[model samples]
Target: MTRNIAMKILLSFLILVAVSACASRQVALVPEDKPFSARKNAEIALLYWIDSLPHVLTTGVDNLIPSPARAAAFQSALEALLRDDPGLAATAAETAGYQVVIFNFGDIRFLALADSRHPGIGPTVIVNPNARRELIAGAPHPVFEEGVDIEAGLFVTRLEARAAIIAGAHACASSVASRCATADNVCPGNGSAPVRVSDAAHNTVLLYQLAHETLAHAWPDSIVFSLRGMMRADNAIVIFSDGSRRHAGVEALPNRLRDGVAATSLSSAGKIVSCQDADDDTLARRSFCGAGNVQGRFLNGSPDACSVDASASSGRFVHLEQGGIVLARLRSAAQLNLSGSAAENLLRGIAAVIPSSEMPMASPDSASGPGQDRR
Candidate 1:
């Protein structure tokens, strides 16, 4: 009996040591010097998944088979939008020939930032205010500045479904633009319109900041538009864009379909809504905020074992929540209810980030091509 008890104690001690050692291991941060050089007229790969079941489900049976037809439709719509854009060469190919890659997975979980040592919610790295100014001066991309807040710690938030899609689209565009800017030594020109606008429902500032970062020149000639979300609701979508400050007695904003969706703006009676004023300090209080703001989460994956695959460093990745725009169409038989008009509008919004002069005019014969298979 004494011998057995001693052996058990020894085994337990060994197990404890092993766990401790594993916990102490740290994952290196992605290199800061990594170049984002996307050539002009470069092919943009659009990768989409039906759901993030692989990340959520444990049992084999729980894994849902994605509908190829749905995936194909989404791909086609996305291709149609980029078909005319001169700045981007859209392709369905995933080969090394492609310069930029955009993944648009439906119902994907945005992982919280993590590492081996601190896996759950990743450690927050505070940036010195002076360093931030220099970083912005050098890069000036949203992915870099979006993550930094007033408190100086990275903030993360869990988003709803549709919001995730919008956020993911914005993220992909920003990444491509950053790469293009780095490669060409000039900001990607916005071809669509001077004033970019979106309804501030469901965190419009996040999207607004993303647009401003990716599309606007250092000194923009036109004002970008962003409005607050619905009354008492925390989420927002781009509902209107006419530069009206008064939220009360405003006419309904037109949706992409020309039909109206019930939406609201920030009340002028209270505080004025501005992206500059809507700093990380204010955002951190929201429940939807992430672990380390946007940049921190982008650099570091989930705070657990499911670290983002840094090895697949082709393009930037973004996780999106399914909100009203996407959720309303969830029950449709098509699986993806995103309309071509809406998709085009969204793409145009992204294109607006690039200057018009930079956007090449496509020939009338420019054919819409199919994108690569879903990964």
Candidate 2:
């Protein structure tokens, strides 16, 4: 009787294992509709910060309206949340009901979201406290920091990058959907995805995302831009052979050129020498317009800028020794919008201008882009 019972138990165990194997095999073969695990993690990370941030910062411009106005502001945020992800909002409220509260700051220079569990806010405008303060103080948004740890930097960089990539993806998918809907054979699927406004805006956001990731990985603490300095020929300098470039901050450029020049690594090359364009101050800094660095000298450009000077060259492939707004600007602009020859040229220029000290001599592709998987 005991032997018969043992045999029956073994048979049942074998059947259970077979069923489990089949389920595992099926799951592995099927593609997920949504990467739920990844999306959930990202959502959690961002929400933690948003929820922790001073309510006024995220609540927007309705606080002035009496109690009625304040309620309206709260409704707006709730409405946006519901419109974007109704199901998620319901789940969040059911699970963790967070409250809205004001943050008392002696001086509200700027405000941003921070993680409630592992908040990474810096008192300084820039992300890195060690960095010079001006680097982040000058920017419209101070979310980007310099020389931050890969794990922390990747968190913010990814949040921004996703916005850009998703915008582009939505545009592409919607365009295809509209065309397909026109044909009766294949009516467009449900409008699960939203449409994006324009390619330019999407591209701009994407470019910023790439730049943010690149700088975070390349020069976590380097100072790239000055906050208030006027950009003069003296402010910009490049050394291709030694690979180092230094330029002025946002305050230097004319308002029109500020976004174009300050937001890129194109200003490191010597001034444009063409006589006709020289009169145009904008043209003078056009040499670095291409992606790669240029080697030469101007009366104002750096002469022997890479001669073992700690100030001129941070002695690191990317000068991240300092942090603050300089690091923020560098981190932000490192990813500029250029293509084919132009992109290569700009990258080459950056490689040449940044001093090579402790980092390996591998090129950008060989070295791996910033915010890469460390594991």
Candidate 3:
């Protein structure tokens, strides 16, 4: 009996040691708690962006409409996000393409700055295939200060380049004919006051930013117009199949139409950017699906399944956001990884944090109810 007891004790000791060693070796990607600086600086940048610029078109050529009323509404929504999660996150848009210059200059601008720094949301910039001719011509395009490369016409952009676009927009304000002319005034790390940019030029960069970070894939259906999501609800929730609920939203901003069914919801948070078709129709019962956010995927694979391959904090995402005027993403880090693969890390530094694997997700193609938050 004594021999047996001794053997059991030895086994227990070995098991404890093994467990400890494993725990010590597996590096923690996520912060035990959220950091305050990312959120704080981001907020300041947002405030400057909202307050500094003059009215420009948030719609038409781009998603950023310059009406004060629209900007006010955007401000309300973003501020609410900061209130909830300080380390904001990737917006609905994933790819920062040159097409954003025509984004109707809508909501893309504001969301870009909001995502730029906090977690350095994925800022990959690419020129539209069609715009290749123009880029070759160098027709006042949005370029970066440093750390950029062009391969197959795609721009591997960074913050400075993105900011240059914003500053260019400020120069092109409705009042003044300025533009984000140089890598000087607007880009970060230049000792600037962190001022915002113009309507058109900035809107262009914002669209670029959204593609990298802010606004996500424009809802591919006219039903998106009818959904009326986007910052509309302060309390967006994603209920999982396991009966768990989370504060999540979808990026279904209406700009164009594509394949998919409607996943309408009675909840306000699910709605991000609602736009009507030409002679825009609102009386129709057009539903929508989700692209991606903190709780979903970026640029959903099909109209049916919005995927969540990975979830990272912020900089750890690699989504390709199409141009648009609106979006909705996670303030939390894990969900933002939808852009590319949270399969790895979240932060660039030790920030590559992914959220719990078994988190809530919207139904990919659940056309059952009008209230299923399947974005």
- In the range 69-130, model 2's lDDT, one tens digit per residue, is 33333233232231333233223322222121111111211112111211221111112211
TM agreement with the true structure for every prediction: 0.22, 0.20, 0.19
Q: All candidates' lDDT scores?
A: 0.20, 0.23, 0.21
Q: Which stretches of candidate 1 lie over 4 Å from their true place?
A: 1-56, 59-232, 238-276, 279-285, 289-322, 330-333, 340-344, 354-375
**Which of the two, 1 or 2, has more lDDT?**
2
Best by lDDT: 2
How many Å off is the CA of 159 in candidate 2?
A: 21
Among all windows of ten consecutive residues in candidate 3, which has the lowest summed lDDT?
130-139
Show model 3 residue runs off by greater than 4 Å.
1-42, 50-55, 58-210, 213-288, 291-375
lDDT of 3: 0.21
Candidate 2: which stretches are off by over 4 Å? Answer: 1-221, 226-341, 359-375
Tens digits of per-residue lDDT for model 3 on 1-375? Answer: 133432332222211110110121111223233333432323222322222322222212232323444333333333322232212211211111111111101122211222221122112222211111111101011222110111111110111111211222222323332233222233234343322333221222333223222212111110111011121222222111100111122222221111011122212223212222222223212212222221222222222211232221111112111111112222111122223321111111111111112212122222332112323
Candidate 3 local lDDT, residue 308: 32
- What does the lDDT read for residue 116 in candidate 2? 23
Candidate 3 has a TM-score of 0.19
lDDT of 1 by residue, 19-104 (tens): 12112221222323332222100101111111210111111221111135433422332232233221121222111111112221
The prediction achieving the highest TM-score against the true structure is 1
Ranking by lDDT: 2, 3, 1
